[model samples]
Target: MRLFIAEKPSLGRAIADVLPKPLRKADGYIVAANGDTVSWCIGHLLEQVEPEVYDPAFKKWSHEHLPIIPDRWQLVAKRKTSKQLAVLRKLVKQADQLIHAGDPDREGQLLVDEVINFLGVSKEKTAAVQRCLISDLNAKAVKQAVSKLRSNQEFIPLSTSALARSRADWLYGINLTRAYTLQGQKAGYNGVLSVGRVQTPVLGLVVRRDQAIESFISQPFYEVWAQLETLPEDGPVERFQAKWQPSKQCQPYLDEAGRNSSKPLAENVIKRISHQPATVMQLARQHKKQAAPLPFNLSALQIEASKAFGLSAQQVLDVCQGLYERHKLITYPRSDCRYLPKDHFTEAKLVVAAITFNSGASKAATSLFGTNSEAFKSVDIGVKSRAWNDAKVNAHHAIIPTQKKLNAAKLTSTLSAIEEKVYRLICRNYLAQFLPAYEFFDVKAEISIGTGIFLAKAKEPIKVGWKCLFPSAKPKAEADNTDQESEQKIPNLHIQQGLKSLAARLDEKHTSPPKHYTDASLLAAMTGISAHVSDSELKKVLRDTDGLGTDATRAGIIELLFKRGYLRRQGKTIFSTKTGRAFVDALPDVATHPDLTALWESRLTAIHDGLSSYQELMMPLQTQLKSMVVDSRSVVPHGLRGLGSKAQYRKKQYRKKRPRKSKSSAKV
Candidate 1:
């Protein structure tokens, strides 16, 4: 009997629904008429041991159990998920061959491997272990994946990397959590302090941002604005605003006290520009082009959904996962790449048609791309480029709509706002690639007010082009048929010849502080910026690197920060706690640095590429962790100040000193 194991029950059930044959249900396993069984693990059935596993007594929190390290790392059945483990064990014992149908990612790989290792299935009992790697869970894709499963042994290094990561997280989480909690308790604090590798660094980000905000001393900066009213060659009066040159420099003036003094630049600039009627000096017009955007990855989807639908990062991932695993309308959920595979072009039409049947954009796309049939093949298919490199794709390509005819009925009640956003993001990107570039004429007019120069700018799009895919970019104004025209349909005019000044007004404005980071903004910051260390090589290595964490792990890392009280959400704003602030302040420069994450990621990639051994890659981390801890402890912890009053705060480090052998040795 062949047993197929999916990542979760929902995915297993979805896969089972499409299989060839009469399927019978066993205890947590589905048996097909063709003597094949399908089962699934509910996420991870087992995880690395907690500190208590070393010694039963260590289960209770104490400083004595400071740095718990076990000789052999053990896997413990997740307390709440042990029932699933039992199901897996029973199915594995009875099966002739096992199919690993986990999600196609590191976390999924690790989850399945841990379950298999825990089952103790020997090579003698199993004929073969096959991997059913799949991006889309549609009927055809699922069937194709099952029919062509590869050996489990082929993904050994991937599984090893996952296992290593899990082990590392456990080691850090357990030891650091215990160390912080016990130390806090010893200092007379009653709260349990939790820390982890990802969570700590994640928290540090929020803390640092909050610190920057709190300490930000706003320097009052000013700008001068001159508003001008102009009669266009073919339209009604239009008002435009221009700012003074040397925006920061001001003309000095007398104070209200009748004493001559250099007044604020804003007042001076506004005063100087108000006395003149703006004159038409120069106008230049040129065509500008904007290309279509790429498709959605997990991170990109989350960002767009957050902005469009105001969904959380976790919410976006959940919706996308549901669409992929349950509805089977999209491909994989946890992907970082944004380019579709070459072969996906054939499937692209089906996806486009499916979405078209339901939305106006479908008709628009069909018109723009010459129907689904003529659309895809006409474009660059199988064009191997850096962006579309197949070698960069791991288990799955970027998230995209699948070829399966999306059940209109299924999408009706099941579609969430976020899911709708995801669908639109995919559909828009797919349609955009084939569409023409946005054509616009940038009109720049320079007007002179006496010696002062002013500028007025406007954009006239010759064609909506790819920009039509974006709902915001579509033209909303009606066409101008009358001799009187709107900015939307206005024609080109010579500056000095056609220009007529109607009125002039001076406007003043003040600059504000930078906007706070939203979920979308923060994700962009994590993935976009050059947050690397001072080392130029390290910066170069991290340049254009994906992000702080993989798409699968980023949400979890953010959640971890919240759970650790490092970050808290109020409305849509995330703020750092006092404890979080102090923690970041107390941490070594490297621990909280994004460069460290980048360096580790670079090394991990090296390990993945077989350029470095895992041991060698991890040696630096191990050394750093030890050294950081040692250095941290040696310092008089300033974090202690916020712990409470000094009397109960400072607990001298406990050392086990040898005692003088009492007369008990003599008696013996």
Candidate 2:
């Protein structure tokens, strides 16, 4: 009997659907007539035992048990899924051969490998153990993957690395949490302070942002603008706007950071340029091209969804998962890669055909590219594009529409509003890849008056190209804050043409503090932390390390902060609580710094690449944990100070409620 194990029930059903049937369904598994069995784990059937399970003494929080390290790790069946585990155990014991059909990632490899180990399916028990790696759940992809099964041993390094990560998190979380909670309890606090490898650093990011915002002082600044006009030979008089720039000799007042600072200087410049004749000293027009935006990786998708639909990061992930798992309309939703494999270009035609077959999408495509035109035909099939590059492809390709034909009516009827929004984004991005580049002309003009030079600029779109798909998308100038002049059309003018200023005005503006982090911006910061670091080597390391968390795990880490009351949301902005700020301030730098996470990720990568063994990777972490615990002993605990104050408030209330016995007792 052949046993096929999958990561989730949906995946198990997908695998079964591809097999030659007359399949008989069991309580928790399916059996083909040919004595083959298919079953699944609801994520993981077994999880690592808690610290208390190791030793009864470890059950209670105490500093004496600091740095609790297990000698031999243990796994216990998760209570909620114990029945599924029993089904899997019976099937594993009865099978003659086994096929591991899990997600093609480190966590996925460990999910099934751990189950097999828990079931005691040793090498001698099964005739052969094979691995199946399929990214898409469609029948064709599943069958094709089954035909090319490899040995499970090939992925042992990944499994080991994943196991090391789990244990490392446990060691840090359990030990640090106990040490801190015990310290807080001694200070008369009554709250548990939870900490973790990923959650702490993520919380640190929020705390630091809030600190910057609170300390920022707004400063008022001034700018001078002139509206000018030039009479053309035949057409209407052309008018445009320009800004004043004072020369160095004028001794223009500037802030310490070199920002323009003087209201007097701005007023003087406006007075000097008002109603004065100005010559266009320089007028340059440069044509430029912008490539289509890259396809959605999970992080990018989450950011866009947050900005466009006002959905939280977790909500976007849930909707994307539905699109991938339930509708089977997209590939994996947890991918970190934004580029497709070079060979996937061959499949692009099928995806395009699927999109063009849908009534709404077909109309949009026709309206933009013109039905029966060469441009439309090329994009509807396949074209060479920057999005297809093998070197940039990682564990999985970018989230894209699968070749499975979508039922347009079914999609609108079945999908929720947010799911439909995300699905349309995925489809539009995929269609954009085959379209021509967005072409535009960049226009800049410099006008001189006295010692000061004023400038104007504009961007004129020459071809809508891929941009037509997102008609409501903001222009680059507006999105990037390039220049206010870019929003208007630049009138035609000779290099030395003389123009008269119609009006000059001074505008008062204050330097605004940094905006609080929205889910969109925070996700960008988490994924692109390299831009924030100064060390060249560390920046490179962070870029290669995949940032703070995996796409699959980042949402959960952010959600964890909210659940623990370490972070709060005000409208779309996130802020750290007083308790959260105290927690971050009290912890050692090693515990809250993002670089520490990056370093660990680098070592994990080494393990996955066969450069280091899991033991070698873990030795340093274990040492770090021991050192951290020892260092934490000397550090003062201040995170739960609020709890102590609350206790005092409650005590005062109790005293007030007591009977007035003090006066009677004194009289007696």
Candidate 3:
């Protein structure tokens, strides 16, 4: 009998749907009439055993048990999923051939592989097992994937990378958490001070940002603008604004950013330029083109969703999962790559149609797509943008809408408000690829009033092609339309052309401190962190890699920080708690910076690419854990002052559940 093991029930059902008909649903496995069986693991049926399982002595948290390294790692069935594991064990023994179906990512690879190893399948059957990688749950995609199965041994390196990462996190988190909590107890703060590989660095970012904002000192700066009028060859004279530039002679009186510090110097420039004859010394004008925005990976989607709808990172990932698995509206949602395979370019027409047909015009009419969805119809479906580069596509393509024919009537009933919004966002980017490039003319003028130079910039629109699709710019993107240059319309002028200078406009401004970390910016910082490293090559590698953790895990790490009282949210802004700041201050530098996380991420990627081994990654991490464990005991920890004063306040992470009304209350 052929057997299929999927990552989850939904995926199992999806696989079973495409199999031969006359299927019988067993307790935990599906039996096809053709003697094929399909079963699933609930997330992970087997998990790493806790430290206590290694030895009874390790059950109690003690400094002596610091750096608790198990001689051999072991896996046991989770209590909640023990039944599922039993089902798999029975099915695995009966099957003649096996197919491993897991999500096409690192975690997915490891979860299914570990299950097979734990099931004690024979070496011959394991070596010959077929691997099924499914990124989309639609019947057509799944059927196509099943037809082209590969040997599971090909992905052993990927599984090894994940195994190394899991064990490394365990060694670091379990050891350091025990060590630090002990120190905190001695400091009068009786809270369990958890330290994680990813969570601590993220908390450090917030705490350090808060500190910088507190210490910043605002300084007054001065600027001079020339209200110059153009002398056109014909028609009415047009006026435009230009700003004065600091000359090399004014270096002493100007700040490093070239903002004038002397009020008297600014007054002189204002007097000199007002009503003076100005000559256009330099003129530059050329058309520029901007391509459509790329489709989102998980991180990009989370960041944009946070900025647009104030949704938390975890909220966005949850909604994405619903859209992918439940509704089948999108492809994979946990992908880190933003580029699409060149082969997928052919499906543009159908994807656009699916989104347009499923507009949910009546009940779910959105401001983005509206009832008509006319924007998609006009998308010239042949214009393949740079987003279709095959070289950049990795693991999975960008998160995208599937070619599944969506039912408009059922969409409103099946999807929530946020799910609909996120679905439309994915569709919009996919449709944008078929639109033309945004073309504009960048016009600049360099005006001179004696020795002082003034400059003006304006952009003239040539074609509002792709820009029509996006009315407003997403935060921190290249499409920010809020700038003055994009709005300004420059009049006709030539070099050496004479112009009349109007009254000068001078405005004083103060340098402001950096803004607090919001949910959006913090997530952005995690995936694309500016690693503070001196090695040029390693720094570039870190910047290129997924920053602190995988896209699938970053949201969880942020959520963990909040649940542990290490971070708090006020409106959209995130701040480190007093306990959080104090904890960071007490720890060693390596424990609080992105450098360590960056190094680990690069090494893991090397393992995935077949350049490194599991030992290469874990050996150093194990050594580092030993050193940190020693420091935890050797160094004197200063407790969080006044932390236990109202210990209950920090302990109240979750609200109590309200009791249901009694029968008497219901009668009333």
Q: lDDT of all predictions, in order shown?
A: 0.63, 0.76, 0.82
- Candidates in order, TM-scores: namely 0.76, 0.86, 0.92
Model 3 global lDDT (CA atoms, 0 to 1): 0.82
**Lowest lDDT block of 10, candidate 3:** 659-668
**Tens-digit lDDT track for model 2 on 627-652?**
98888777766556645343322322
Residue lDDT tens for model 3, 488-567: 77778889988889999887878889899988898888877654443577676764655788999999999988877888
lDDT of 3 at 542: 64
Model 3 ranges with Cα > 4 A deviation = 232-235, 360-366, 370-374, 407-409, 473-482, 531-537, 639-668
Residue 30: error of model 1 in Å? 1.9
Candidate numbers, best lDDT first, in rank order = 3, 2, 1
Candidate 1 whole-model C-alpha lDDT, 0 to 1: 0.63
Lowest summed-lDDT stretch of 10 residues in model 1?
Answer: 659-668
RMSD of each: 9.1, 9.4, 7.2
